[model samples]
Target chain A: MAEMAASGESPEILFWVGCAGSFDDRYKAVTQAFVKILNKVGVSFAVLGPEEACTGDPARRAGNEFLFQMQAVANIQVMNGYNVKKVVTACPHCFNTIKNEYPALGGEYEVIHHSQFLQQLINEGKVALKGGGEFKGKKITFHDSCYLGRANDVYEAPREVIKALDVELVEMKRCRTKGLCCGAGGAQMFKEPEEGKKDINIERTEEALSTGASAIAVGCPFCLTMMSDGVKNKEREHDVKVYDLAEMIAKDMGI
Target chain B: MSILPQLIFLLVFAVAGYILYKRVSYLRRNIFLGHKEDRNDMKEQRWKTMVLVALGQKKMFKRLGPAFLHLLIYVAFIVINLEVLEFIIDGLSGQHRIFAPFLGGVYAVAMNIFEFLAIAVLVSCFAFLIRRNIMKVDRLAMKELKGWPALDANLILIIEIVLMFAILTMNATDQILAERGVDKYLAVEGLFFSGLIQPLFQGMSEGALIFLERFAWWFHIVGILAFAIYVTYSKHLHIFLAFPNTWYSNLQPKGEMKNMSEVTNEVNMMLGIQTETSNDPPAEIGRFGAKDVNDLSWVNIMNAYSCTECGRCTAECPANITGKKLSPRKIMMDVRDRAEEVGKSIDSGGPGLEDGKSLLGDYTTKEEINACTSCNACVEACPVNIDPLSIILQMRRYVAMEESGSPAQWNAMFQNMETSFSPWKFAPTDRFNWADQLKNEEAK
Candidate 1:
């Protein structure tokens, strides 16, 4: 945000590189993949870089409303100072909090999840889906993230992006409104499970595996982590691969 | 009219009225334990919600079978109470069939309709009893429904069935008495269900028929009074509370969380968006989130009182399905129980506010609260629109801010968010490094 203000030039959109995108080793690949897609399409977008803060989704969800408001206020102040109007984020938590919660704190922006944004770029003929991609005709199932699918009601955009890859899309028994959580929401990603009969991620991953798909597609970073960990736990990491929707699109483009 | 029976009737009625008043007052005081919140906005929408949800049984019909059965009891319970007004007047004035002379044929029509509903109520109560006991529905068998809740459900169903039977038997015996030309016995016909059972009293002595008539009459009226007071103590309280609970329901979008203005004001002051006045004293920071019943909003207390303990929320909860400790029904039950405890302490002139126990520690544990995913499934599944998530969030606030008892991993995340502006130890300058890598790869 500061870089844009000092340069006296504005990008068409601001890419919100959330905490996981910025630092988590596994999700950093997703960040790189989404960036490649943006560059390939020649879309003008800038990152907050050192000026960005966590959107406080985890803090607020974990019951620290005070900390959440503080973090939200700081980020809103910086973004407002830059006159930032549009934002696109790969993380649904950030997408949800900023799009829904930030407006009450005086920070309003036209926020879009990366899946929807990618679909829009394709719809506008800005990005082309080349035939014979790596996932062409491959069986891929999508796991709906609680925040993205249930909370925000964006079920079709990510699936549409997968369809654009020329891949056969399968679905788990519990999809869309009835989709089970990946057990990583509500800040549970930062803590240990509190003594359950079975881990929720394992149960959800079992449903994904039952679809006989070779790859799982995800829209949110938290779902990616949980689904990937579930695949690893089942020792099917060799058989099944978990790819974020952006990564599959980037790989298919040969970027 | 005999003065002796009239005086006896007055004494019995006063005792029941006193008991009913005491229980209702107790409930009112317990509900007021929480802090005030204004849910009076959007009056038109609130009225529509109450009518559709509580009156029309809109949400209940999601499952057709249970909805049909519950509607039978709900409709009968409401319509049959109209008969109670006639009973009160007849019992006090020593009159038999007082409305019979005024309405003439309409009186028999109304009584016929009441008889049919009485049978429907009896059948529905039996079906519900079997569902709770013999069939053993899975939701009814959850851990939260054990002991008192389980027994309370069976007890109420049995009482309702008995009350309906009393009505039928009273009408049947009165028909027999009228046939024999007994005094003060109106020869009313078209009694439907009761008329079918009139043969059981045939060939019996007149004195025995009159005795049975008076017994069933007194039992029906007195039983209704007891049921009224008992409802205040049981989960059946939803019969009365579901209306107002639906009225004060949250009208915001399901995904939107209500922002705490107190925290917002502090944030605005810190951000220099709103300057604090020099005359204003430093704001005293209270406990961050709710710690007890008194800290929660009044709507939350109302939600607690309005919970039906049906376990539908728990049945749909992903956490419960995955075997987590969290049961949304249990959370509401615990809140109501704690509120009752605090209210009773106050009635006894003891330390009510400082009961040395709280809704957080003594009742609900952190394990259950943490197990929640905040998915809003429970809130959506509730027929009365009770938002268990609100209470869960507030209790979690207490755990996070007041006790600082969150897991070490969460504390690390909090620390990371504090210094690095992210939930990681990396510097924010490296945030866009992924884009830089993409540019280099493309240049190749």
Candidate 2:
């Protein structure tokens, strides 16, 4: 981002909060801090319009191919019209679709899920980290989102982000590749839940709780909501808190 | 001087000729019977399947014994038709004997050979009728055994066998008349029955024997002509539909059935399924890919028209064998019927395939398509090789991509894919955990 900015032309990493991040203020605050860092480094960025609607990912899944194409094409044109090619989003589904599905519809761009983009900054030492605020005592558990892990084949960046924060990253039995769903995909957020054998969010939340972590740190807006809900509903509200990865990192960096 | 007999002979042969022409034309143009398919590699398949299957009639003898039965009948039908022409021409032309340029004697010997073979062919057809109609064999289920009129099959068999016998009887009668000095054998002199009939003929007169000779010839000719016309209208229609259907058959495997991807627009979907109440959108409208039978691709209709009702498709389909409600053959028939029905509503100009609606909902429902393992068994096993799997999958793609009506799990997964770049719904920050195990190795 800094290199793109340092060049004579204008360069901005379009920071997309996505629907999931919009509802979580902590995520918003941390994400804004990252934007502040970019600005301080003289790198430019723009957030999506607050009213930015969905990119039609849920509709595509429901066999609404028409809706998916329209949403995808419209979104791509919007992004391109800004002359922006680089994007960062907290939601992996948004990130993957913009990066992968959009290409099928002739919408191509360089997209990075935020965890990945942030890890690169840390590895390059481009962003300043606090020297005294070490996460030397906290045990943190990481949750992998389907979009980031399976869709984009990103599996290491988030762990590296937490390791940089010096937090002990723990795992639930259903971590990494075999991770269970949080029951919030496929536009299920818009529709009422079906009577499944068990609430999927409750099951996933318990899996995280079982890890005995002080906090369940996540990367997606939907996973953040579901896991936090899972923590509250399981009465583990006092023991485990769900923090978006950005919130965890920005705080560990003393920003 | 009798005109009745001669009239019948001319009329029947003409009708047979007419049917032969119409059936060939219908099979060719309607069913894509002779289309030269442009496809990927299959030079050998073209040779063995395209050339060999129709000409060699290899399917007839796949089971040596049963193959022998059909082969005998098929060969006999072709042979006997030769004499049918001779019988008609001689009866109408005031000729006492069938005209053969080189070998009158050779023709007689062939008639005798044809007579014995006719009996064998008749028996085989009769057995097929009984097995298919009376016994209701499961093997023939793919073929519509109904509307087949087993009686017509019997009638054809009986006519062939009886006509040959009548030839024998008429010859016997002629021999007796000649022996009585009633008629002349001209070629073969002093034949047996001619002598016995002479004593009685001395009492009767020459006019009577001559009249009897004329009667036998007319009866033989009239019978052949009547049967010829009947065969044309019948399922012996395959006599025509099979050749081109075999030649122009779909070359693709069932699974890859091709149809344009129905790319549905997102803004339109948020509006929901279109109805009469739908206010027109501000922009150009997009309707469903296919709205009714006329909306279906012409290839679908062709599949239906080309069916010879051989039942080979159904016999090999695992779904039909497993007692599923799906029958690929029935699907073809229904598609044909619906296309015709929908065609009635279309302009005479004939609409394109995309303009017609699919019959997928009526016969092969979404459940059926989903249930299919996408196995290409049906396409491979088909004698004509229509690819049903492609049609099934295309429908699924339309439903999934356009309708957005899939199970919620996949929707959730898709949502995950859109946001997280993977199908499993998860936190974007945690996307990199799969690399954790490989990290140490990468460092080395």
Query: Which digits, one per residue and each the tens of the lDDT, describe model 2 over residues B367-430?
Result: 5444333334445445454555444544545566557655666566566556653334555455
Each model's backbone clash number: 0, 67
Question: What are the models' TM-scores?
Answer: 0.89, 0.48
lDDT of 1 by residue, A1-255 (tens): 566667898989999989889888889999898888888889888888867889999988888887898899999988998889999999989999999899998899999999999999878878788958889999999988878876788889999899998899999887876677888888888888888889988998999999999999998888999999999999999999999989998888888
TM-score of chain B of each: 0.94, 0.64
Model 1 chain B worst lDDT window (10 residues): B275-284
Candidate 1 TM-score to native: 0.89
Q: Which model scores highest in lDDT?
A: 1
Give model 2's docking category: incorrect
**For residues A1-255, could you state the per-residue lDDT of candidate 2 as single tens digits?**
223334655556777656445434444554565555565455566565432445666554444555466566666656665667788887776786677666665567888988988888889887666634546558888887766664455779999888887667898876664455565554444444543345667777888888888898888777887788888898888867887777766666665
